[model samples]
Target: MDPYRRLVRPALFRLDPERTHEAAIALAERVGRRLPRAQIDPALEVTAMGLRFPSPIGLAAGFDKGARAVDAWAAVGFGFAEVGTVTPEPQAGNPRPRMFRLGSDHALINRLGFNNPGSVVVASRLAAARARGRVAIPIGVNVGKSRDTLAERAVHDYAAAVERLWPYADYVVVNVSSPNTPGLRDLQARSALGEILTAVLDVDVRSAEWSGEPRRPVLVKLAPDLSDEQVDAVTELALELELAGVVVSNTTLSRAGLRSPAAMTSEEGGLSGAPLRLRSTELVGRVARRAEGALAVVGVGGVSSARDAWDKLAAGASLVQLYTALVYEGPSLVRRINRELARMMRERGIERVADIRSAG
Candidate 1:
């Protein structure tokens, strides 16, 4: 019997979603050090954006918003972990009762609004962890514009965050796709995105010069609601800017096919989980075809199983991430997915994750 589904999940489901998340993070932080490290199969290892990933499955950004328990995330089986939708300055996010669970639909809707401890605090925590040699896997920091920052200053906001976080990050993500922040998604437009990426790249260059470390790779996270033409434009711009990758997608505003209750489904926020699986996969394939190996694609949206992860890889995703699935499936799902993925690869006579695209 799965203890998480039978015992832990029931108790967790009883609490308010935000509170439950807080408790889970606290517990992981305390127990992380004592947890046994996961033994990942060599066949499941991957190298993307010049960083080695022990497994393709990674804990996506939203779950570890404050950079908490990254080591624990790895201990459980994730190959990498991306933390934050952090801002240059901290702000209290939207009002409470923000996160909603649609158990039947296997989805979650949140308007958390880039609520984080800001770059300074998060950077300090990561620095402390690095000093102790606790971060064993690659840690990517996803940065967003501060809510109060004006549209014109958005580039400055993103650049400031990268300047502060570069030393501690394996890669930095420019999050212009989150629908929670009012004008956030507008930054995804090609001209706007180009300006932001240029400024962010400039920050990376300066940070690398100052720290004597190689420039940290930068990626952009896009929305799942974009038109095919819009997606192509962004992919072309990303290539021109020389970005390391694109995280295909943040969350969506669409409530199109949800099976959850009206009150829950009616919530105004970004939707994720099973409801988003197909569209995000489609976007991943679209972006992959557009990128043509020039930019890596980090497929994330509704991934919950080995088959889901494999599908993303087959669609040309270099890596895969999940958050809502972890909410439903528990930590053990990570190892299970990796184990199944390795078995699938062996069955197909495929040896490398990169070859999944051509296996057919």
Candidate 2:
């Protein structure tokens, strides 16, 4: 482990999780430009969802809520960055003290409730990034329903956000996961998910025509708490809809194996980070096995080290993403994880990252 894992992250963790996150973004924006281009081994490059990623390591959504720090994160060596779980209308999300750090478990529980500046503001920032040519790799926009959006009108809510942000995003994700959103996860029911995906993809096709570019790829993010039956249904829907892929297993509401104190345990929200590694990995593997190459799987949750990432890959993740680990491990963790991943790939005599998509 890097010395910062022991030294720097501990200090950062002492601060409130949300405040430290903002501070980290500010710092990255200041110094990210100076960081050299990440030296990723060619073997690590993989194209998925119609975009080329320098490596499999990506920053998951909910980290950059407003698409405000794309260049900063890209400079830090993430192969791809997903921003926002933006809603149709701007929202303050849950009240303060919504994010809590469980350092002992390398986990975090947050009820931020998609606190973002809404799709319009995020679209403007992304447009600016594109105009400035600041984005180095594919950037995905994850869209969700507004808290006030009724369940019956979910399609309209999602379509509105998709139409607004589609031009700026290399790909779009229909985030029906996120445990913090009431009635959100219910949308993952096969019938509900199908309607949402169909509506979003329809918008994507029209948006592409308007921009004179190929249709942007669309994927759905699922909750980790799903049953195998739900996973199977979602996998079928993906194939039926001809979606680009699936983002297996978002943060879980389940608090199993959390080693943090009882006070920390009392906080409500989805749990992510180290404590989630095993269950998330298992879910990824199951999805991969079930999907059977029908659609790509972007494995996320609890990926802290190269070994954890490799395990996810072996279990069937075409790409891997992390958010909570970055909180506990520091910015340098991205490069370190990629480098070690390359080494591990070499040790395994693998030529391409996708070659191990189901090594398990």
Candidate 3:
């Protein structure tokens, strides 16, 4: 283990997970500004969704909830960065102590409920990042429903957010997967998902016309707990709408395979990290096989090492993302994973990262 894991992470882990997250983000922003850029090989760059990515590895949404740390994360060797789960309106989210660390399971349980400074604030930050040239890679913004919003009005809320942030985001993710948000996951149903996506895509079309650029890619992030039938239904919807892609999963509510004691496991929230690896990977593989080149697949969940990333790629992920691993392995995790992935690629005589998109 690195010195930080042995010494620093343990200390940080002792604090409330949410507070520790804020502190870590603050430290990364402060320290990242002073650090020199790490060198990355040209072969690592790949293009997808009409945008170029320096690497296939991206920092997932929910890490920089309000687009507050894009520059810092981008500077740390991320191919791209996704911000938010931003709602149409700002929200305080669930009560305190909503985030828990399961060190033994290499996992996290968060009921953050898409707490953010709202789409307006996030858009302003993104606009500033663009002007400052601090956001080079494709930046995707994840939008979710407001906690107070009723399910019947979810489309209006989502549409409003997309209209505000579409100009700044390289792509927009309609998030209806987080289990913590009451009735949020219900939006995954075929009819509900279709309506939500239609509203968001309409905004994409309008933004394209106004800017004279192609319509930005719009994707949906799904939860891992869905049945295969549900996955197929969502895939069908994605294909029907000509959607850009699907983020294979958000955190899962299931607590299976947890090494943590039963008492800790009983804590309410979505579970992310190692325990989710197999299931999320399997879901990605299934989606990739089903989508069959019609849509993009962004694989996330339980990815902590290069091998884990490779599994997701081989299974059919055009791109891969990580969040919880950064909490466990530190900022250098991106650099380390990319290096190892490149080495694996070279070992396999692969010329491009996308070459292995369907290896499994």
Candidate 4:
């Protein structure tokens, strides 16, 4: 009965991964227009970062970098959508052929850079979506430095994005974690991250004043390749900065257990999907244990099913994200997970998804 796996996926998988991704987004935008809003169970609701998401599952940022598919996420059943790893201006990103599929491993390695059409364009698109009454749920805007921006100047670059998209966003994410951009990961260090956070927090205050609105939440996303010491350091910094929360992980640089051919495995980019599930879940547990209720955690990287989502929540993730799974499992994955997750939650006598966070 699954048409995506039976027909759509077979055809999409036949093309190169990046182009297929583009086609998927275009298809989503078109399909989203005709689809009815996704139904949800109130028990699946999660309130975090000062907003209430109808479900704990969200679509990660890379899937809609330019905010071109705001309505598509809601139409497809995501409780929320985090869009853009957007920068100040448009860039071609790395050269083409940058995304590779590892069907044997159910994973993807992508070095797409932050190839968004820039913050202005993304903000405009989001604005239009809002005008049309399309944003049915919270939209988190993930902002990062431009590829050409130096480490020293990165703070201003991030500040610029938060300023540009501030009004429309339900929350903002500071992405110093993606490996595709040169020197981007270096910003995760204490001093560098402190500077960026300070500037971004200032920008939030400015946006609040400018719009006469409440200050929006700003959280940090970290690359999974960080050492324990580094992870602890970043965690401490997040707590110190009093951030809205932390997204426990971004794509990883590790290629430890991939079954894909060496050529595909050797590709330079962050690896996401099943291979990342365990490590990211552990990190979620670690960070959750470390934060000890001082901060919120959004678990991402490798969730695909109800059990996977359960693992993340039990490990202390208040919410979770899906990206690569959508590539392999199709759109129904979110709703299916929500349905099964609700069943699991009910068995435990819990009414809200938030109750299971760190339950184990």
Which candidate number has the best TM-score? Answer: 1
Tell how far residue 310 is off in model 1, in angstroms: 0.3
For model 2 the TM-score comes to 0.96
Give stretches of model 2 more than 4 Å off.
1-3, 33-35
- Compared with the true structure, what per-residue lDDT tens digits does model 4 show for residues 1-360? 688889989899999999888988998888887787789888998888789999999999899998887888887888999999989888889998899999988899999998889999998999999999978989999999998888899999999998999998999999999999998999999999999999999999988998899999889998888999999999999998899899978999999978999999999999999999999999988998999978889999789899999999999998899899999999898889988999999998887787786355
Off by over 4 Å in 1: none
lDDT of 2 by residue, 137-255 (tens): 88999999998888999999899999999989998999999988899999999888889989999999888888799999899999989988888889888988889889977899898
Whichever of 1 and 2 has more lDDT, that candidate is 1
TM-score of each: 0.99, 0.96, 0.97, 0.98
lDDT score, candidate 2: 0.87
Best-performing candidate as measured by lDDT: 1
lDDT of 1: 0.92
For model 1 the local lDDT of residue 323 reads 96
| Local accuracy of candidate 1 as per-residue lDDT tens digits, 1-360 | 699999999999999999999988998998997787799999998999999999999999989999878769889899999999889998889999889899999999999998999999999989988997878889999999999999999999999998888899999999999989999999999888999999999999888888889998899999999899999999999999899999998899999987878988999999999889999999999999988999999999899999999989999999999999999999899999999999999999999999998884
Ranking by lDDT: 1, 4, 3, 2
Question: Per-residue lDDT tens digits of candidate 3, residues 80-110?
Answer: 8899989988999988889888889999989
Better of 3 and 4 by lDDT: 4
What is the RMSD, in Å, between candidate 4 and the native fold over all Cα?
A: 1.1
- With a 3 Å backbone cut-off (N, CA, C), the pairs that clash in candidate 2 are none
